[model samples]
Target: MKESGLPDRYENDAAEKLSPEKQLSPEQQDLKNAIKAFCIAHQHDEHAVFLIEGDAGTGKSIVINSIFNEIQSLSRSSDKSSPFWKTDNYLVVNHPEMMKLYKNISESYPALKKKDFERPTTFINRMHKSGKKADIIFVDEAHLLLTKSDKYNHFKQGNHLEELIKLARITVLVFDEKQVLKFKSCWSQGLLKSLVRGLPCQTYHLKTQFRVHAHQDVLDWIEGFCQKKILPMPQKQTFDLRFFADAQDLYDAIKKENARYRLSRMIATYDYPYRLDGEDHFIREGRFTLRWDRSKPDEKLPWAERPDTIDEVGSVYTVQGFDLNYVGLILGPSVLYDPVTDGIRIDTSRYEDGAAFTGRDGLQDPEGTKERIMLNAINVLMTRAVHGLFIYASDPALRKRLVQMQASRDAA
Candidate 1:
């Protein structure tokens, strides 16, 4: 029997080649220069720590790639005598899809290879044993750093970030608190203070968004909606942001959009149990049905870059570090609105990400961790679309509530 995998999806690509937005905004450029300078100045010192705090679409990948190319080019141009030429830099990403994508294009980047791109713990373990400290380590999706050993990792631990700080002469980390999907991530600003410990450290925020061409109004709605902040949904925007009354309508629209424009796909919350009985349709409601693409551990093709994945709905693990043109989001039964509280309350028992939750070294509040993961998972899917977003709720009350929220402004 072919085994099934996890259910979920997310927005932001960890690999630069898969990133749609290549051009860097001014803020991203400035951050790149700052990052370059920090690395250059600390070529021989192991006390440099820089944190880049940016939400999704702040051109973090673009900036990191630019600096990498610049450094590699400078190294190549230097006549082999310059210390700049000897600097060894590694660009690491914590997401699996991102790592897989990077390996496919690693040959083009002479400075980095499929081997250099790795999870935080593996990178930490390998570097610790290398004897020679690396000149620089660039961590993308830094918030996904794992703090414990599980089935995937058997490495001895302290913390992933602390190892990078100790072993690398210079470290560049880009993180957003919202992107902390799994568990045991110390990527927060407060954690940075304790980790750096008086080292010459600095933090930079990337404010210019280069993803999601949809208006800020749509983005604002996504934020408030996920947090259950009781805000009205977007009425009008540069791109489509609408709720479909029926799942069938949204599914039809998604198929039409895929036929017209390539790369459109549906991503859903972990509401349904994995249909492992060799069924083609993983999700079915009345006339609406779809199959989520299960992760093939050996598959090298990244879902976002592959054109054949249109028939397969993506999971949070596969799409977390990527983007899509138009997204059809299914807010699963795990999340719903309570009329009494008039706010969102996640049914923790219904959520499916508990298997991935690591807790505070296996000593955390399981219920709380599950809720956080569920919210982050849906938030990732809701924000995946660059041009448009269509949403369908699994819970009837929540579906009606979203429609009411969208039409509330009209009532006013």
Candidate 2:
């Protein structure tokens, strides 16, 4: 079924409205100005590239959309004869894999169809054919952009960043360096930092945690951990598993707290070895979800049609771009980390063989690899809530860490 045919529950309204209250914070405002200035100065330039960096829940998506809106506004305000007014056309190239929007688009508009909507190359070619260079090209969740080398045989030398820049005169890349997982990149923070080593393009960072409430103090603690490299104590003696236990319990809790804090409705994030089966409460059935991990080649998670009721668990990827009033995170076993060793590691061996599997950025700190992944995952997870957070640990060590953190806070 096309987008219209799909149920309203699955529809995403993130980009639907420009919030009346949507005013830029100082940091975001500075970055917005930089984008505006660059476009103004390079109105006639062949191409320009910008790299936007932030951790999860940093408002990167909204910021990028706001810039486009501003560009549109400026175009209208400028004199018709001014080049700025003429360069009003823009393109927002979202990572369809990150959001299932493209699939719906292709189903709705057959002319703009792609066999594999998740592949970056599909969007790359579409931009290339647009003919008129876009005023701005936004690559949301850009951390997933594949490196030029990883391109399939058809695009052996394909670089989504370069192709996107080629499609637009001004290209704005939106990404969280900490969320780099699915795809390797040559246009990442490391590459941009080095490439723009002495360049004049201005860079800005968003430090405010706007998505989460400071009520429970968990958001602050998590932010402190991510930015300061120190894990702060939780507010309780035991990590609350309210939302992660079972669907009925989570629903009851949400109903009880609905007056004080609203829980986000069911958002089933597709992940390895686990995917929701429509109405079955099992992972094997009609759900159309797909999980891409090399390790689980033999493993096929079940998927079914949408259930009448929503589920509580989600993958880190799907939930990163969204925020719930209160979130309950179920940390999958694929991740492994050690607090004492300060060692972070991900057993990416399941994805590929030896060094090649983890890619370049992944090579460092292979032992506690999941720590950084967990760090990033937790950052995305905890920040998704506005009022409160409850982390449910499946792993013994992780559970211990949560318990200890809560104990320390109680003792204090």
Candidate 3:
């Protein structure tokens, strides 16, 4: 496999690429500067929102971190004329794993403290109880913010973004509609626009794919598959895309890659049984059997970064918003191939993540909504690979179709 042209640290942890000291592409730098100007212009405005829209692997997190670091620096500066002087700001993420990364990244910058990083619920409740307002608030993975009340997380309010806007002078967030995985956090472009309808808002889209080394056709193939269309595999070879007939072979390939590249690991759809309770849940395929990711009370690293995680299978919850140098994806029982329609099908009945479907009471179409969430989970898992993507399907028909597609591509 060819090198991804990224530093080793970035390959090991996706959050490392979001460091303020890292270099950004020309387009990313320009977006950062524009956002800074927007924040400065609206520093005292009644309400303002800047939405940074992009797909996975578009370097949205890097831009958000860079802009937040500059905001912190200017706020602490002694210059009296600076608009950010003596201002208060915070960075929030809805995902716990991603929050862990942001907090770890804070140790490298003197201007950014671990206190400055918080989960959305914690930040919202803090501001609400204290009646304290922030000057600028940066949100990463805004799509994961709760759209409905999730009492388990202690977010009584229905909309997190709305409450966040009320607590800040200016709110900047990165959103990808495809990454919205659950009914509670369900988001659409229309819903997002509705929230900031009356506020002074600006939207910017980052089109370039910065994390994945694959060509455009390869990405299109992945997107088409997620949309239930199995298009012909692309013939170009800039990135590695492979299909394995057996689960053991896929695991062996991933192990070889992990030994050579250091960040390769296997991840599966939430079709298999798994829960947060203290018990071992295993995914057994043929001769291959491995346990699902376990919570380690004393472990400081995220699931993907933990040294022992290579021996386990990760789910969307643990790997979303992160990158892997090479990812071995297991398309579990819920994902099926429909021979009649010559398309993909999502069997929601086999999906084991019941929490994802909780609170679907008012949904206009519960079944359709569930299907979309399942597809979104598959999309997030497929797009995580930085250099290569290896796939294995548990459904026999799907596995056969994928193998035939690969064979045809090779023959061409």
Cα lDDT, all candidates: 0.71, 0.49, 0.88
lDDT per residue, candidate 2, 1-412, as tens digits?
A: 0011222243233433122126777887887788777767766667766777776666776677666655554465646765567453543444332334423333433222233223446556555566545665656676666654553324444456656666666767776767654324423466656543543455556665555545334554666644423355544422232323333444445444433433343332222353333232332212222222111212222111112113434445545566555454444444445666543334443221122224455444544443354455556665665545555444456556656656666678
Q: lDDT-based ranking, best first?
A: 3, 1, 2
CA RMSD, predictions in order: 6.3, 8.6, 1.9
What's the true lDDT of residue 248 in model 1?
Answer: 83
Best by lDDT: 3
- Runs in model 1 deviating more than 4 A are 1-21, 80-83, 109-112, 184-187, 275-281, 359-366, 407-412
lDDT of 3 by residue, 1-412 (tens): 2235545443546556768878998989989988998997888798899999988988999999988998898888888788888899999998878888888888888889999999999999998999899989999999999999988999999899999999999999999988888889889988998999989999999988877788777888899998998888877575789999999999999998787777788999998888778999999999999999887745567788886899999999889988888899999999999998888999999999999999897788889989999999999999989888999999999999999999987887
Q: Pick the candidate with the highest TM-score.
A: 3
Residue 237 in model 2: shift from native, Å? 14
lDDT-best of 1 and 2: 1
Model 3 TM-score (2 dp): 0.96
What is the lDDT, from 0 to 100, of the residue 354 in candidate 2? 29
Q: List candidate 3 segments past 4 Å from native.
A: 1-12
